[model samples]
Structure formats: structure tokens, C-alpha cells
Target chain A: MHLSFSSVIEILGIMAFTVSGAFSAMQKRLDVFGVLILGFVTAIGGGTLRDVLIGNTPVSWLRDVNTPLIILGTTIVTIAFKSSVKNLKVTLLVFDALGLGLFTIIGIQKGMAANFNPGICIALGTITGCFGGVLRDMLLNHIPVLFHKELYAVPCIAGGICYILLRAVVEPQIAEGASVVVISAFRILAVRYNWRLPRV
Target chain B: MHLSFSSVIEILGIMAFTVSGAFSAMQKRLDVFGVLILGFVTAIGGGTLRDVLIGNTPVSWLRDVNTPLIILGTTIVTIAFKSSVKNLKVTLLVFDALGLGLFTIIGIQKGMAANFNPGICIALGTITGCFGGVLRDMLLNHIPVLFHKELYAVPCIAGGICYILLRAVVEPQIAEGASVVVISAFRILAVRYNWRLPRV
Candidate 1:
């Protein structure tokens, strides 16, 4: 069966998220089963949360096993490609940044579609984008990257607003693509320059 | 100032949950800061998720600093009396069971106040009563004790049914105490007898 356009993008975003999570678990030297759990939780945790907050019962993931399957599949692929994962920190970071941009925009779009106000939409989007990674890090007994200052949550928040304003001023599709671009660029640039939150 | 009746019970439940979490963290040999995070999360995580699901603003703990203070107090007390924690495992287990009972009732009660269905109310109660510990264990890199062939989720489920049914048959205050007693006794008995879900 032919997949819908939106489902395709969502599948890609979810796949990217799962791969990043698996790689992080691998970095921590977790066992294979542990890697699977970490990837599954990290891929689903934020969206499960966003959906729960938005009153989506059974959660988006519990309703759709495909997402979890995709994560499991990606984890297998990562395991098969362990050598590459070992030498590709830059590439992994790029993929993580991409997932961050994509998921955050989609979350904001969902909130707006539900007709929540811009501020709430932005907050939902921020939660959707960063929470998975935060959870994964926390579960690994490490301080989450978001908490340790990475200029992370702010970009999601700002780009969510950009999506809202972009749609209001222009075409609808531009809002999605443009907002993703804004977040991705900001995140990559922040990493490139070692930007971080102020200590004070 | 005169506190609302429910608020007093809520604070007690939070304290119990916080103390239980801190004790568990100490059992796992986490640092002082780790104990603090565990306590805070256990105390507030369930309610935060519940409020967010209902689309409440700012989250419950964020709305009141007192919750943070309570969690902090629990953490400090647990650390200061770390030696006592080991010897007090049975006592901690009893309080943990109490926390589970109280949280189930409160979550079910909250859902009822929001006019949620019995099915959803039971689920909310289960989630509220259990997810915090699941989270604590997962973060400590252990499989959740609840999912481990155990009587953990059962008491919460039974208690929720009692809360819903008793409210239908009796006064609200009496139903509250009755549900708590039912849940607490159920958990204590299960622990004493080593009852659990059979392995899949």
C-alpha cells in the first residue's frame, strides 16, 4: 500500500530518532537488549508525552506499532553497521540535529492543528523535541545534554514560533520546511561554535 | 491559612513517594544529587504527567514551590540517615505501599473530578501510582520492579476499582479511606506472601 505523504515524513523522523538513540546507547556500552529499550524509549518518550498532554489516548505509539518496528529495525541496522557508528561522531550529530528539527516542527504543527495558542504550541514542540534525548541521558545516569547547556531547547522554541509566524504570513508548507531549516541551522551552528548557556 | 482537605492528603502522598524514591536510590548506591533527583521525580512525576495529560498549565509542581521543598527535605533526610535506610527496608516498603495506595486514589479521584470515564480513571491511577518508580528504576539501570513478575500494579488496579465503586456506594470521605486501606493491605499481603505475575 502506498503511504500518505505525512506518514512518510513521520516515519523518517522516527527512524532518525531511533538510530540516534541506539547510537547513544552503544556509546554507553549497554547490552543489545538494553540498546533496544533505550532506542525505543528515546524514540517514543517525547511524542508519547506530547500526545498524552494533548489528550491523545493510548498514545501515538501504542496505537501505531509501525513506529516501534521502525525503531527496532534501525537498531538492527546500527548493530550491523557498528564499525561505521564507531567512527562517525560528526555524522551521528548531524542526524540527531535533523531529528530534532523535524520532530519539533511536527509537534508544533500538531499543537496548532489542535488550535492551541502559539505559546502552548511552542512549549509542546519544545517538549516533543528535547524530552526524548533528555530521558535517554537521564536513564543512562548522565546529566542530560539539555540541562548541561547546549543551546538546544531554545532553538526548538524559537523555530516553533517561526513556523507559526511563517504560516500566518505565507504558504502552509513553507512553515514546515522553513521551520525545520531554521532549527537545523541554528543547532548545527551552535555545535560548530561550541555555544552554550551562560553559567550565571 | 486553612488548607483544602485534598491538598493535605496530596502533600502526605508526595512526601511518602519522595521518601520511598530516596530510599530506593540509596539502595542502589547513587550520590546525594542522584538521590535528590530521584526523590523529586518520584514525588512529582506522576502528578506532572497527569496534569499535562489533562492539558493543565505549568504542571502541578511548577505551580507550587512547596512540592520541591518537600522532595528536598526527603532527600536530605534520607542521606543524613543513610545507615537507617538499609535497616528500615521493611518500613520503607510499607511507606512505598502506602504511597502507591494514596497515589492510586488521588489519581482516580482527580480523573473523576475531571469527569473522566472509569476506564481512563483506572489507567490514570495506575500510571500515577506506578510510573514514578518505573522511572526511578529505569534511570538506575534496572528493569522496573513493577513489571517484574509482581503484585505491584495489581494493588493499584484493585484500589482504583474500589475507589470508583465505593464512591458509587458510599460517602466520598469514607470511600477515600476505604480504598487506601484496601490498596495498602493488598500490597502488604502480596509482599509478605511473595505474590507476583507469572513470567511470560
Candidate 2:
């Protein structure tokens, strides 16, 4: 089967999230199995959640063999490069932003395909973009960064609304591409400016 | 619709879990909305997880109006009796155990209805029983009690297996009722005796 543009972005997002999870596990001194588990969960967690909420079962990962293989490959690469990977912080953040943007659009599209309300679609998009990190942070026993960190979910929701608005006039691919760019740029700028949500 | 025996237990479980979530939020000094959100998540989190994993969608709460109402009522009661609720530690634990036992069976049955493998069924049962509290603890920024506490998942899994075994020889209702008794007893005893799994 020919891989679509979104499919490539999805794989890239999975790899980025996997690296983030693996790094988190290493920082916490988790065992090898824990590292792999964390990596897998982080990469697919948000999508699994979105699928489940929408009643899609066995999840997307179980359906596609390639996703797991990619996660495994990413995990091995992360472990192999553990010493040098620390120096690639900027690259990692960029990949993470890419993953967030791509996953957000994917989630919104899935929700839209299911004919959910726009509000539910936006919520699904935010959950898709942000919950993987939230789950990763939670498993590591810390507060989820999405709850109070630099604007993450906000960008996802904004981008999702933009996608919905743009889809009416633009081709689906164009709307998706625009949303991805908007989300990634918003996240990158927010982090650069050290923006944070007000703590309750 | 007429409520089944398991349905009553399920509602009770939802209320108990909601109370636990509300208390955790109060301890964290979260505002009213936070408290309500935590309560709702804790009460529905596990089953929502199980359903999603097995392809059940919109989740049980969204299907049944009663579950959300129970959670809402429980949250209000928890807030109203905050001063007195703290003193009811034993009561809370008992209710939590009741919820755990009931939710486990409900989860198992749902998995069985979906025709999952026995191993997956048991896992679904345990997740259903335990994940709400895990989510609750995570939201409160604590390590999941299921991972390190006094034998939580063990009982759920063991009870789930028993449920499967008993179903072969007894009526389904009998098997479910037996499993609930076994799980709740095991949890109560473990807590009373301070039983814990060995750390890896």
C-alpha cells in the first residue's frame, strides 16, 4: 500500500514520542522492560485513547505491524545512543513538536470521520496531541506538563478549530498541512518564550 | 430498564471511586471544577479504559445517564462532608474494595462479551478494577497504588481467573458473584495484614 503524507508524519511522530519516553525512563533509572514499555506507551498512548473513546478496538497499533516495529526500532536506537542522545535536545524537541502537530490533525480527522460534534472533535484532537506526554509524565510519577506547562493543548485546540474552518474551503490535504504547521509553530514559539498556563 | 445485581454493584463502585477522587483533589487543594473533574475521571477512567481497549465506544457512562449522576452526587456528598469524610477512612477503604470487586467482574464480562482471549479478559478485568485509582493517583501526582500497594492488581487478576474458571462449572451470575466475594475479601485481608508484592 502506498503510504500517504499523513502516514509518514504519523510514523515520525511515533518515533519522536518513543525517544521522549525512553529518555524519561532512563532518567528515572527504570529497567530495560520498563523503558520499552514506557517508549511504546508514549508513542501510541494518545492514539490508543482516541481510538478507544471512539469505539475502535484492538487499537491502530495492533492493526498495523509497522507501527510497533518502528517503536521497537526507535527504542533500540535511543538506548544505543543514550550517551550522545542527550546532546540532541533541540532535535528531540523539534520532533516532539512535529509529533504533536501531526497527531492532533490525525485525531481530529478520526473524530470527524466518526461524525462527532465539533466540540468533541476538538477535544479528541487535543487529547491525541497531548495525552501521550501526559501519560508518560504520569507513569513517571510527576504532574502532567500539559496541565501547566508551556502552551501545548491550547495550540492543539486552536489548530483543530483552524482545520475545521479551513476544511470547508480547502482540500483535506491542504487543511491538514496547514493545521500541522500552525500547531508545530505555536508549540515551538510557546516553548521559546517560556509560556506557561496559570497554576490553579 | 430493570437493573441487574451487577448494575447496582457497578453504581456503588462508581460512587466509591468518585469519593476517593474527590478526596484526592481536595487534599491537593484543587478548586471545585478540578474536584469534579477528578471525581468524574476516577469513577469512569478504568471502565472507559477497558471499553476503549476492547472497542466499546462512547463508554458505559455516556450510555447510561445514571453513572454520571452517581458520580456527581458522590462528589457533592464528599465535598459537603469533607470534615467528617476524612474521619471515615475505614468506610472509604471498604467502599473502595466494593468498587474494585464489582468493577473487575463488570470488566471481565464486557471482555468476554467481546470474545477476547482468557488472558486478555483477566487483564481487562484487572484494568477495570484498578485503573480508576491509578488514574486518580496519577492526577494527584503519586505513584499508582496498584504498582506498589498491598496486593491490589494481584487480587483483581486472581479473582478474574477465578471468574473464568467458575464460569465453566457454574451459572454466569454465580461465577460473577463468587469472584466479587473473592476479590473483596482478598483486598480487605491484604490491607488488614499489610501484604505487599516484592519489589523487583
Candidate 3:
């Protein structure tokens, strides 16, 4: 299959999400079906939510068969390499950060296409970047880390603002790439520095 | 305002959902904002999901300004009457059951209008009837009762099937009303009998 640059980024983002989801489910001792289901949910949950909110129906995942196949494949690969993978938590974090960046940009672009205001677009970006993990946590019967945890959504929000600002000074493609990098880097740095939001 | 029969049913269903949601949040000792948010979510979440799945854009709640107002009014009344309300558990269950039945019919009809298969229609009906509670439970950091608790979704499924069968032999209006009654009665009876699905 001839993969375009955009398609490659999409696949990588999906794979990252699937890996994080599979690892989380495995940590929770879910069964094989549970692991696969969680992986699929994490991979597509945010985008489906974004599409639904923006009134884009037959959600992107439903229309594209390859997305599920990729999730299945990623889950299997993660499982097969489980024993060989070291620093499992670190691996999950890295992939999650990458997916967060990619998905946030995708959501922002979709919001812009729908002619939403900048604030709404930023909200959509944060939701798209963060809600997959939120859904996964909710399914696991825990308060979403997004509600009370590290600097997660702040980076997405900041990146969204940066993207909007950058649009005036840079090419659209350059702004998109810069925003993704900014989000991913911010998240990784936050984790590295053990940064967290103050409790109320 | 002259209320049509369908509008009355819709209002009743939304009110039931809002009351149950408000009660659940209050039980958890949520603040005013949380209670109001949950009430609104419970009233609209199911229909929003149904519309999004069927590619219905600009979800029902977005188009209708009164729904939010109704939810807010219901939440206030529930909170104000909290002390006077006896048998809170029973009241919640009754309202939830009633909401389930009414929403199930609304969903099944929507799917039918979309020309979905009976199986898909039934799925949609069950989702509409059950997912509000699911979202509420998830937000409260608990496993959704729909997955492992009492006979919650079964009645919705059974009612959907009943509606489909009834449509073949009865008037459309009769089918809708009968299905709603069947679902509500089945759910109430199940609770009364403490009927539960056996663990695998």
C-alpha cells in the first residue's frame, strides 16, 4: 500500500494509542478480548468523540476499516513483545504523549473546518487528545487522571493556542508540525520534571 | 404552550432522566455544578449518542434550547425536595426505569427512520436507554451498572424486539406505547424480584 505522509503520521498515532491501551489493560489483568477492546477504544475513542461533536457522522473509524485492523495488529505486537519490553510505564508514557500530540492537531483542524471559534477549537483539541485515556480510566472504574493528575491537558490547550497564533505567521503545514512538537515535548518535559497541578 | 402527546412523553423522559441523575450525584455528595452537569448529561447523553451514531448532525439538544432549561429546573426541584423525598432509592429506580422505556422507544423509532436493520435498531435502543446511566456511573468512578448489575439493558433489548414485532401486527402508535409499558414494567418487576444476570 502506498502510504502518504499524513497516512504515516495517522498510523503511528494509532499504533501509539493502541500500545498504551494494551499495556494499561494488561496491567489491569484484563482478558484477551478486554485488552483488544480497550486498545481499539483508546485508538479511536477521541476521534469518534470529536467527529460526533462536530456533527461529522458515520465517524471516521466506522468509515475506515484499516483503523481497527491497525489496532488489532498493534495490540498483538505489544502482547507478543511484552516480556521483551522494559520500562513498561515509560513506554506507555512516551507513546501516549506522541498520540496526544497527533490527535490534538487532528482535532483542532477538524474544529477549524467546522468554523468553530478558537476557544471551542482548543476545547476540541484538548478533548481529542485527552478523552481516550479518560474513557479508558472510566472503564477501569477510576477517576480520570485528567481530572486530578499531572500536567496533561494543559499542554494540549497551550499547543492549540500556539497553533492558532502560528497560523498567522507560518504556513499551515509548518504550524501543524510545530504545534504537534510543542505538545509532545511539553508533555514529556512535564513528566520528566514530575510537574503536577495543585490540588484544590 | 400546547403540548403534543409525543412532546409530553419526551418531557417526561427527560425529567425522569434528570431526576435520577441529580439523585445519583447528590448521593455521591457532588456540589451544585456537578449535580447540574450530571442531570444535563443524563437527559441528553443517550439521544446525542444515538444521533451521532446514525449520522444525525447538530444533535437534538443543540437544536432545542428548552432541554437544558428543563434539566436545570428538574435538578433544582430534586435538590430542593431532597429532604422530603422518602425512599430515595426506590424513586431513583422508578424514574430510571421510566426513562429507559421512553428513551428506548425514541431510539428504536429513530433507527427505523434511518432504515437500519432490526438488530442495529435494537442495539441503538439499548444504548439510548442504558448509556446515560453508564455515563453517570463512569463519571462517579464506578463500573457501569449496565455491564454487570441488575437486569437493566435486558428490558430495553426485549422492548425493542417487542416493538419490532408489534409494528408488524399493530398500529404504529400502539406499538410504541405498548413497548414502553413492557420495558418499564419488566424493569420494575426485575428490581422488585431482585433479578440479576448470573456471573460467567
The clash count of every prediction, one per candidate, is 0, 0, 0
User: lDDT order of candidates, best first?
Assistant: 2, 3, 1
Best by lDDT: 2
- Please state the error at residue B43 of candidate 1 in Å: 10
lDDT of 2 at A140: 89
Candidate 1 — what's its lDDT?
0.77
What lDDT score goes with residue B71 in model 1?
A: 77
User: TM-scores across all candidates?
Assistant: 0.57, 0.63, 0.60
Per-residue lDDT for A147 in model 2? Answer: 52
Worst 10 residues of 1 chain A by lDDT: A142-151
Q: What is the lDDT, from 0 to 100, of the residue A185 in candidate 1?
A: 83
Q: Write the per-residue lDDT of candidate 1 for residues B102-192, one digit (tens) a residue.
A: 8888888789889999989999988888888887776666678889856878998988888888888899999988888888889989989
Model 2 steric clash pairs: none
Cα lDDT tens digits, model 3, B1-200, are: 99977677778778888887788899899999999999888888888877877788778888888999999998998888877653576766676677788899989888888666676677679878877877887787766665556577789989999999999999999998899889999999999998876431
Query: Which residue pairs in candidate 3 have backbone atoms (N, alpha carbon, C) closer than 3 angstroms, thus clashing?
Result: none
Candidate 3 — which residues are off by over 4 angstroms? Answer: A1-47, A53-55, A60-134, A142-200, B88-92
Report the error of model 3 at residue A54, Å: 6.5
Model 1: per-residue Cα lDDT at residue A145: 59
Cα lDDT for residue B14, model 1? 76
